[model samples]
Target chain A: MPEITYRDAVQKAIADEMRLDDSIVFFGEDVAKAGGVFKVTPGIYEEFGAERVRDTPISEQAIIGTALGAAITGLRPIAELMFADFIPVAMDQIVNQVAKYRFMSGGQFTVPLTIRAAQGGGGGFGTQHSQCAESWLMNFPGLKVVAPATPLDMYSLLRAAIRDDNPVVVLEHKYLYTLKGEVPADASPGSIGEAKVVREGADLTVVALQLMLHRALEVADKLADEGINLEVIDLRAVAPLDSETILRSVMKTNRLLMVEESPRQGGWGASVASMIADRGIYHLDAPIKRVNMENSLIAYSPVLEDEIIPNAGKIEKAVRDLLAED
Target chain B: MTTDSIARLDRDARLKALNTMTTIRLAEEEIQNLFMANLVRGTTHLAIGQEACSAGVAQALRPGDSMTCTYRGHGHALALGMTLRAMMAEMMGKASGACKGRGGSMHMTDQSIGLLGANAIVGAQLPIAMGAALTAQIKGSGAIAVVFFGDGATNIGVFHESLNMASVWKLPVLFICENNLYGEYSPVRATTPIDDLAERAAAYGMPGVIVDGQDIEAVYSATLAAAERARAGDGPSLLELKTYRYRGHSRADTGPYRAPGELDEWLKRDPIDLLLGRMIAAGEIDQAEYDEMRGAIEKAVVEAIEWAQAEPFPELEAADDYVYYPG
Candidate 1:
């Protein structure tokens, strides 16, 4: 096993794929000369040169739109959007053009393009800079949405996304860029629609994503002596959700707590909660609980940000309440 | 349009251009009739009066060149030599359609003919065309992608963004803006600064060309020059064709927003009439030949309609197919 940063894992995935196929290329705001804003793609420029690794203008629409067109004509393009919030600027291309082209073109074209964006609130960036756009992207059919929480997951899922014939959006959390973990020497490429049970238990099931997954695990570790056995499920790919895995856990544990960083309403957390009630309600012994942001904006101040964004305390409290109710 | 280009056209080339213009004109007219009779399932933006632009540019393109256009792109598709039967079937939502009934009029595509698509979203295909050109540039394919859009589409963010990026990257692309005086119902004057839409190309450090949409020869010359420049690695060019569409925007609304006698004024410069008159005056095509060509087109369109009508509807369960590969 080799310890690697999540940032390196993503860069390696792109670099490795580009080496395998000359048709693979990437371009975005600062991906070439300056690597990337978050330094996720730092050495890609020196390695791939300017032709394969390009630095585009400050036009998200053109970045994604050109990739869609290039993908149509025998090229695999990886478009890096600086931040997820800026996705709306290219919504027409992403939603209408990129998502529907496969179905609309009647399979005449396969979009082997990967759209990467850094999302989630942590760096005190304003509202425009930070946003988890999984829900909005998941709404569009013919799009594969995958958010990896660990370095290994980042490398493996990115490979899966690059190989998938459909258009894939890889949402990487801003906070997890530098997170270090032990990734196998040849990290096994992951399937996009699969989920992982990072920690096992039979008492309660806790489903979380990105930074929320870390918080759920932290709470699970602290509650071990308190007789709380928490089963932690990491939702790697939110779209084409690994529902069978979550449902199987719910059927055994009977209690579920879902955590998310986006706004409470219409967020991924709401979808998970609905999925449990819609299908797994019969096996539940307690009500499904969701610890989410209080339906408010992620403010700049550390105090206000901490209040809105869920944390280990919130997950622990939610788990205690779900257990005390019985 | 310079009369020199039309005069320079040899007899055969002149007749072929006229044939293309007439086919586009008749096809759009037939689509209108079909829509009125409820034979076509969805609405279509007719390119009746703007046939010259599609005919000229598409004819100018080499066999390897790529093209994409707006929703009002039946003329462009026909000009690219796509089978009228396939296009008609697509618009009618038949199983034998170009896209197998999944994409209606707005999203018609056939990669075999190098026609990427006719997108419904305004200005959406500009960047895609840029990408195609980029791919060609990277692969040294020596192919150029000509994207056809309208005046209204120019106001979109992607239009300007794509132009700037294409010019900056020196991608092999030609942008064709068919200024048909309106974006749907709103006249171009109200929506855009109509003085020199082509001048925007200068901002991106590329050449801007303005031509008469009613003049097929003028359009062919301008597009041929642009495509040549792009293939030579001189970068993209913007060509704004000043034309007009006689019909309203689409099938649903009867366009009543025109100025008094506006339709009549534009109708005088219809491309089909312009080409027919020029070719007839030059003895390249006689009255007898023109009548035979038009009669042949009419007969072919009837056969296409008959084929489409006889084609079975796609299976109901097939709607779920192709949402993803091997789904």
Candidate 2:
């Protein structure tokens, strides 16, 4: 076992995968010489060389489209968009071309590509550079979206996404990059559409994704002192949602609290809550509770940002309120 | 560049060009009838007048070379040697189609014949074609990618991006702009300031050649030279073929843009008819042979129609089948 940060886990996964498969190449603004804006791809250029670890121009559309082409032509490419908010420039490639190619081509081609971008608002990067758009991508049918909240999960999920035969969007929360945790040395590549239960409890189940997963776990620990059993599940992948695991947790705990960092409207929490309401409604003893950011652009100021996003206190309060219901 | 060499193509190549154009024309004509009869669904952009561009460019390409086309792609697919039966079946939404009926008329693709795919989105194929060419260049496959687009694609930002990238990277690609004078009922003059679409390539520092698209010999010569340059790793070239489409932009168009006299004048310069006359005057074939070729083409067209009509529709559950790998 090794204590590694989430950023190091991602770097290790990319390095390991690139070592195993020569076809796995990386490119983005400052990803090569500068080691990526977030340093997730640090020192990769020295080991892999400039050809494989490429530095591209600031054209996001070209970055995505070229990666897509390379992916379809037998190379596994991991493209880094500097920030998640800048993904709009490349949306045509991601949404129209990459997402639909496999389905539109009748499965003749596979887009084995990973688009990694730093998401979430906590670094005072303002509205343009911050914000989580995982829900917007979830609206598309042919894409797989993933967000790993911990070091071990990041390592395993990155490996899994690289091996997938379809396009995968890995959203890295900028706030969780340096967060450290114990990661197993020989952790196997994990499945895409499965939820990992971080903490098991009997009273209430808290379903959280990305950065909010850690918050949920913190809330669960805090509520444990009050004799309230709180379970926390990290939804690692979003598109091929692990509804079964979430519903089974609801069936056991009989209470649910969904958490996400995206806007409250059409967020990952809304989808999770809807899934539970549709299939696991009868199993629930109380209505599903959701904890998400307010439906507004993330502000730059620390106080305003904190006011907009959901926190551990909010999760703990939401869980308490759900438990208080009849 | 010599006229003597240009005239030495012999009778077979000439007849083949004529035959290819005639096949495309007849197939599209049959498609029009089928569409009118409610047998074919979705939009069909018939390339009736632009046959020489497809036939000549397709002839210039080697068997393993690749092609990407715009939504007006029936000609490209047919010219690339896809069986009329498969194409018609695709247009009719039958399982026997090239894309298993998933890609209707606009998106037909046959990888076996090097037809990468016909994209419905304008200028979208530019980057994809450049990528294909890059793949060919990297693999040292000697396979060049030819992208066929209409005059309207010149205005799209992706077109410029692709051209610039191709020029900078020196990718083995030939960008063929079929300047049919209109972009969905709107004339090119209304939108474009420059009359010559080939001139746009000047921005990328690539050689741009404008050819008489009605003349199959002219198109063949220009494309052959461009293909040679690409194969030689001299970078991509822009070949703008000045042509027109006899039919409307799509099936729903009544084609009222052109006057009756204009239609009649353009019809007189039909590529198929011009090639047939040249072959006849050169003693390439007798009237009996010509009539026999015509009769055979008609029979093939009818058989293709019958095959499409008799083919089975795709299964309902299979809609999601090809979206990803089954395994």
Candidate 3:
């Protein structure tokens, strides 16, 4: 096992894949000389040289569209849009062209493009920079979405996304970049739709994602001290969800709670709630609970941002309330 | 009168260009008739008055070169040597069409012929074209990529972004703006400030040229020059072909926005007539030879329509396929 920060794992995953496949190309604003705005792609330009690691203009449309063309033709392009909040600038290319090409070309083509962007609500990136837009993409059928909660997951999930011949979105949370974990050299998380049970328990299933998974585990530790065991499930992949794992957990504990940083409306949490309501409701003794970012623009102040989004205390309160009810 | 530049392609190539332009005209006319008869289920955007641009650009490209176009691109797909049967079937939404019946008139693509895909969005294909050029540049494939968009598409942000990207990276792409005077409903005079769209290329540090798109030889020569530059790694160029569309933008548009005599003025400069007039004047073909060529083109159009009419629809079971390559 090797310890690597989530950021280093991403750079390693890209380097490993690029080493194996020459068709892989990386580009975005300052992805080259600046080594990415978050320093996630440092030293890659020196290793791969100018031809493979390109620095593009601030045009999100061209970035996504150029990658779309390259992907469908022959190359596998990893495009970075510095922030998830800027996705709307290239939404036409992402939602209309990139997502529709394969289906519209009638299976004649595939856009093997991976667009990476950092998303979360904690940072003082304010309104323009802090947005988790994976929910908007989840509605589209042609795209595969994944958010890794650990360095190991980030490495394996990205490998799976690049290798898969589809338009996959690899969402990196800015808050989780510095978090480090021991990653096995041979770990392969398999596909973009698989889930992992981070902490198993029989009391209540607490499904979480991204940084919230860490928060749920901390709450699990605290709740354990109080004789309230919490089963923490990390939903590594957001789209093409691993419903079987979620359903099994709900059936066993007869209690389910989901937490996310996206706004409640039209977010991943709403979708999870809808899924359980559709199929897993009969297995749950208590009503399903979702702890999500409040439906408002994330405040510029760090204190206000924390209050709007979920924390360990909120998770504990929600779980205790669910257990305290009938 | 056969412009010496196009005549340089020789009599055989000149006839090929003339024949393609005529076939496109006949095909579009048939499409119009089909729409009237309630036969075609897809929306039709006739390139009736803009044939020379498509034919000329297609003629300049090598075998492996890639191309994309706007919704009004039946002429482009046909010029790139996509089978008439496949194109017509695609227009009619049949399984035997160019894209296996998935793409209709606004989205026809024939990969074997290097026709990437025709887009419905105004400037959506520009970045894709640049992407193709990026691939070619990286692989040293010696293949140039070209995108044929309308005058209106030049206003979209992607157009400027892609042009800048292609310019800085020196991507082997030719941004051909088929400036057909009117962009759907609004006239060019009413929309863009500059009369010539080519000059905008200067802002991106690329060579910009304007040609009388109604003149097939001028288009062929300018596109050949641009393609040569792109193939030689001189980067992308913008060519504004001042052409016109004789009909309304789409099948449903009657085009009342044009001046009362504007339609007649542009019709006189019909690209097919210009090419044919040149051929007759150059002693390449007399009236009898002209009649024979017309007959051949008409026959081809009829056969394509017949083939399309008999083709089957795509299987419904495979609707979800190809979204992820299934691999």
Candidate 4:
């Protein structure tokens, strides 16, 4: 099926997991032989040479503490952070050493480590290289985060965040890296806190992620030609937040909305509207609208970056103001 | 005596470096009497007079080499062999700990003896021991790592981005530093402007040296000549050592900004009384077999603090076991 390009499905999910894990490797700043400044890692440093695709030193905390010290001594690495707004120059190697080294070494270390980074907003690289840093990494809990809107979930969630043992992150979306799709040359990966629902419709739900899940599927295909359908979903991994498929699509679309692109203060759509108002608030009939972006600063000017980011006409006006409050 | 591992320190490697510097000075005096009987909680940082830079860089590494120190690492986790009842059951937090108590005592890990932890942060274990020496220079695994910091993590920034990416990837790694001249109390000439922190390893071109860190054969001959120039791939070196920290950066910091006879001048270089006065003047032990090998290492640090204070403290639903990686 090879129709590729979410930057060739993140360079075929990191050259198909460094050709089935020769314990993975890869590094950052111009990921080797000067390929990735968003060239996504061209020819993986001429097919994994320079000792597994090397090239580092722009040292974001020694590229995430040498990918949490080569994932606790065995080596899985990956690293890259060319810009997830330089994750606060490596927030103490991703919140105190790759999320507290396997719970403060209690499990004696497992950090298979992946990292990647690029993040969202639609280029204009303003406000510290555009924004959406998956709500500054879903507030930490040993970091998983994901974010791929498609070239098949960026080749199955970056081959499930480089075969997840733990420290994941990924992000991508510098405007869905050339978008495209088809994928399947062994695509697989679905569950890092699942949430696909892609289109369906009972008249509301929405949710969104990465380029606001393609502007909530172009506002659910132009509100399914006025019959007002909607549904959407696509979240893909904001720290295991499937929230049981957005509370079973808000108990048959009783109207949720969210949509984001960062900044409704502490966003991943305010933890999916505080987990659907703490346990799908009587299976939502309204009050969860979100639409986000204005916490300010994006501004490079594609009309002040499309007047504060959201779009598909602000998810069809927050899905017609939550289907006119049901 | 320059790197034939300091004329191969024999006499049972100088009485196993005076029984690993008297089991790291009786496990930092039983982790300062288990933090004065409150049986250890938060802050500890001891390295009591540095124990010959963790018994001379864990006697020049070896067993699939790996390390990463600081939080004044209980003398590099008892010079890399770990045990003393899994570091006093992870400084008494228990459940048979070397991390079963979820890494107490500034996160000490054992990783079956490679001790891949002990980082309370300062210089963040030199980019995770330069990423475990770039995983032994990409799994040709002649393994080498060694980190240890201090001299206030040489004014950190991931210690100059882990020594400029471990000397532009010659990797393997050794870095040491233990220049305990005081980072936690502010002494290395008022937060170091350089009275030699091994000349910041010449802005990362490696080979820095400066040892005598209370000697353990001059830090096992400059960490066995920088771990054989990082297992012959020739990279990373910065040794430093120049030790001291008889205490005070944590738990009862009697350091009172020491200047008054600077703790009797580093307690007159007491690295286990200068290797038991050079194994009792080279006649090899005599103060009655050095008081029966320090009364059997203080009866094995008082039976590893009464078997880590009769163990068991972890089961609060195992505090949601190791935060992640369960699958």
Q: Candidate 2: which stretches are off by over 4 Å?
A: B1-8
Residue lDDT tens for model 4, B119-227? 8878888888888888888887788898888888888778988887889888888888877777777788886676988887888888898877887888887888789
Specify the CAPRI tier of model 1.
medium
Per-residue lDDT, model 2, residue A212, is 87
Q: Which residue runs of candidate 1 sit more than 4 Å off their true CA positions?
A: B1-7
Per-prediction TM-score to the true structure, in the order listed = 0.98, 0.95, 0.97, 0.43
Error of 1 at A236 (Å): 0.5
DockQ of candidate 3, scored on C-alphas against the true complex (2 decimals)? 0.78
Per-candidate iRMSD: 1.2, 1.9, 1.1, 10.4
Taking chain A by itself, what TM-score does each prediction score? 0.98, 0.98, 0.98, 0.36
Rank the candidate models, highest DockQ first. 3, 1, 2, 4
Question: Model 3, stretches more than 4 Å misplaced?
Answer: B1-7
- Model 3 lDDT tens row, A36-130: 99999999999999998999999999999999999988999999999998889999999889988987777778788999999987888898888
Fnat values, one per model, are 0.76, 0.34, 0.75, 0.88
Tens digit of lDDT per residue, candidate 1, span A30-139?
Answer: 98899898888878889888788899999999999999999999889999998999989899999999998888877788889999999998878867887788878888
Better of 1 and 4 by TM-score: 1
